[model samples]
Target: MTPFLEFDLRMIIVDRLEKSYGGRTALKGISFRVHRGEVLGLLGPNGAGKTTTMKILTGLIPATGGRASVAGFDVHEQSLEVRRRIGYLPEHPPLYREMTVRGFLRFVAELRGVPRSKRSAKVDRAIEQCGLAEVAGRIVGRLSKGYRQRVGLAQAIVHDPEVLILDEPTVGLDPKQIVDIRSLVKGFGGERTVILSTHILPEVTMTCQRVVIITRGSIVAEDSIANLTGRGEMGERMAITVARDLDGVASTLAGIPGVIGVDRAPGEPPTYHVSVERGFSGKELLSAAVVQSGCGLLEMKTVPETLEDVFLDLITEEHGVAA
Candidate 1:
């Protein structure tokens, strides 16, 4: 007999979820999902509906149309249950500046409905997990911006919810602080589901397993980072740099097998952007052709599209310009 499976693989689901504020639509039927133990990034510019989507998922705000669910509980119909299964750290975390870190987290634990007996242990675990041991007894207001952010994260996870939603978790901190906070966030994957919403592209590139890009209150793209940046409709892009500036380089590369077109990067002499046809894996052929033509091949590497590239393309196409 086969082994029994008890847990659902998908931890969160948003289906055609829509929201409006007064007369403005904040989300235009956006939809996505987060699987168990996965770190998904929600990326967009300001007023792009990332926070709105997160609000709907966390039961902080109701969606005007469609539906969302967390841990198999409908966000609208089973809000309390949904809230119980998720932890949220908004752009500005709810914190009492006068309270010490330990006291604040203990308060959050009690408010989250942890038993009196288990509250200390829960708070301790959260403090440790968020690297707040040194500042546990320090007043929240007295702590550095980085430590305060950690405290905010501690409070969010104090109850050990199945999912964590972090909005701009590293908005205003020093470079070191950003690195430390990023390390902390990166450690949450594979044990708990996380939905990180931020305007920082490098954060998503370094931390998330997959990404969903929203623009003008709608989802413009969603895919694993590799796929989003690697394979395009035209195929992969190879950046070839030659030591000598050979005339007719563009035509020469375009004639090679699997080569679709070629263009020169701005202000980058002797370096050409070669677009390959779909399903083509002929970087070697392209490189050999360049060398055979007597153009000294300095560097040849596949240039995967960056998240910024993908984001600008989608948002520009959607609104006819950057948002």
Candidate 2:
């Protein structure tokens, strides 16, 4: 049975987590939580502690300090219990290339503690769930990279664990393969708690409900995709086209209250990009301004802020580093 979609019930928790190697500090007291039956993306640039956090959570390595738990079991103190409740897919698929797809899944199911009598049914469910039924008999080494990823995912889910941790699940996939895997992962909501770690921005937008952005071994931002992109101080952007192409058109639009900045692109029908306060209504004000200014408003459209834009803005704001 799947867990009901409950925000109050947290499935994973990390508190004041720190990690180090030799003289390098990898993670600096990062903290976050994943709700039960939700998809959370741990996003960051390469070497930004995304994988390091995943490794620690999956009990693959020891954390220098702090605490982490999955399904209420401490990752370090209750390693075996934690592992039993979670399915982990690292950056690289740990597939026995020599074994057939079906064989590899059976092996993984057995290793994951599925009883002998239940192994076959569990394996069959995983195969069908991951769209691997067609290639179940093919040798894993002979299958394409896309198929290999499917096998890896199927193996992770064979035991039907409550938590699924995926590190760069679509790292080496082609466009179609990426889309296919995204569709598969997107279907997992409400049935499992998923932590999808990746540097790819679209992956988070397409598959996750919330995100934890890490940079230089620290947590910079954590919130729902809507709140992160919608509540920024950057405000709403607009593109206003003027048919008259009059001088001072930029100034005219800029004079409107709440319109912060305006610039005209070079052309006959000049297009002015206008920046306004986040909650301001721009259409009527802009239309009236352009009409009064005699610039002859042709068209005005809102420019939306995407997750990528928000990510870049956050990275630049947090570290003052250009993206």
Candidate 3:
């Protein structure tokens, strides 16, 4: 596919973005893109330039250097147009305590340029879409945290913007509320593009199609969730419980052509979690080695690869290199 179609005219594009606070740099020339119709997870630990990038993308702040464009408009030159095409939910949901959910939504629609005739209909749609119907008449300030968050989401989408930028969308939420918010985000599916920033790895796995991991104010890795997690041939990990001794088990497995590393889990009759190198299938070799060693393989199955592993590995490996 052409680059335009591949990235859908670049829903979010940042080239060598740089920012500094006083003399200390907060961003060191970071750059990445979010494609249309895809939920791209922007992941990093605290101080990783995630929020800084989001702020720049949403026109909250100006970049010290480099270029940015969202929804086909240059962020610097076309800030207003860019804002008009995007929806944003900052870490702190902007809300008015005295305004009911319905009132706040109508105000947001109007601010987004919705016509008077269509404002009510738009507000109603957003309320329903975000599951705010039951709480629509309640004052936003008096609503539960989850309901308030839902109202924030509703306001972001009230104008039907082409792109949605959410920072820490699931932060400070209970398990049930997190699930609800993720479900609401998933409902955005193909109709709008999503650029979500969060430290939560599982959230990225559940809601995002691709991931862009940043660290030290720089882009570290970017790829589809499948590629990042080794859903392809490379990402398979196995946990082996052997009835044999733990001694040298890690080394023996490490010697296998496809085995990456073997770490002993803390316990008796030690079990080891083995990660296979990318593009290597070590299952058969593992079985053979267990059989040859006269060790009974207690259990072995394909465990789903986690974004946490990839995130930690990348960040740790980067630090190791810098050190």
Candidate 4:
């Protein structure tokens, strides 16, 4: 059967994908899609089937059940075509430590079937984009950890495939290298379909337009960061401060219609965190409720929910345990 996204504009699609090793299942019917030119993140904690999903999409492993396609080519039956269309960077880079940076990229380009006429130009462009020109002549084995990472990135883009899949691209790097690699990853997003598979929350928040959150071999949530932060279970929240800490001040605000919960923060004037249900236009209502209760409304400001909070909340809610 033709997949819905196969005929549409989506760059990749996975439907009911499953994988197992002997008795342990790695992925349990997890599914998601990535649109062309869109950056999507497969986010999860360690051992959450994220890597399994990437391997299947990249044709490095076979899914025991279900269907997955990239660029309208089946991953199982058309792996060669899928590989030709995708440039993947696994968690630990596959590097020939004995080769020079330029030589290694040239070799990768050759392996990926780059035409002899354009191979040098492609290799040079990848080197420049990954900031590896300074070490183009350096041996991969002798380079610093950061430099080796740059080499990894250069090789991934050396082929310039239609889709780019990076699995934990920034792992094992220091803070500065993390920042540098993130900049390169950001640049690659809009030019092609990029799937960033990582466990780090900041990685998704900073670069991805949408996220697929998975845990325990199952997908728990998938949506744009904005939707998850503003409209999800946490809902719309506001930060409020009152001039005086009246005895019934907490109860007064809690009495307001549509107010879900009011929490007090540590401060002189007594600050309150007011959370409301979805579709509740409680800004003016909250202000009026505060004043009518005989308390001074010193301040009121909207506070968008953090991704960390939403991620933890969804995971914990799904599993009925601490995340």
By TM-score, who's the top model here? 4
**Whole-model lDDT values for every prediction:** 0.87, 0.88, 0.84, 0.88
Tens-digit lDDT string for candidate 2 (1-323): 22222224789998889999999999999999999999999999999998999999999998999998887778888888889999989999989999999999999999999999999999999999888989999999999998999898998899999999999999898999899888888888789999999999989999999999999889888999998888756798888887777777788778888888987767766888888998887669788988888977788888888878888877778677523
Backbone collision count in every prediction? 0, 0, 1, 0
Runs in model 4 with CA error above 4 Å?
1-7, 266-269, 292-295, 321-323
Query: Sorted on TM-score, highest at the top, how do the candidates line up?
Result: 4, 2, 3, 1
Error of 2 at 8 (Å): 7.1
What digit string (tens of lDDT, one per residue) describes model 3 on residues 191-277? 899998999898998999888999888888899888888653345677888887646667878899877677787886757888786
Angstrom error of the Cα, residue 315, model 1: value is: 2.7
* RMSD for each of the candidates: 3.9, 3.6, 3.5, 2.5
- The local lDDT score (0 to 100) that residue 7 gets in candidate 2 is 29
Return the lDDT, model 3, position 123: 93
**TM-scores, in order shown?**
0.89, 0.90, 0.89, 0.91
In the range 1-323, model 1's lDDT, one tens digit per residue, is 11122247888888999899999999999889899999999999999999989898888899999998888888888888878778899989889999999999999999888999999999999999888998899999998888888888998899998899999999998988888888888899998999999988999998999999998888888999998887585577788888887788788788877888898886655789888877777777787888888878999888777778888878888887544
Cα distance off (Å), candidate 2, residue 232: 3.5
Better of 1 and 2 by TM-score: 2
Cα lDDT for residue 70, candidate 4: 93
Report the CA-based lDDT of candidate 4 relative to the real structure: 0.88
Residue 318 miss distance in model 4 (angstroms)? 1.6
Q: Is candidate 3 or candidate 4 better by lDDT?
A: 4
Residue 216 accuracy (lDDT) in model 1: 88
Report residue 126 deviation for candidate 4 (angstroms).
0.5
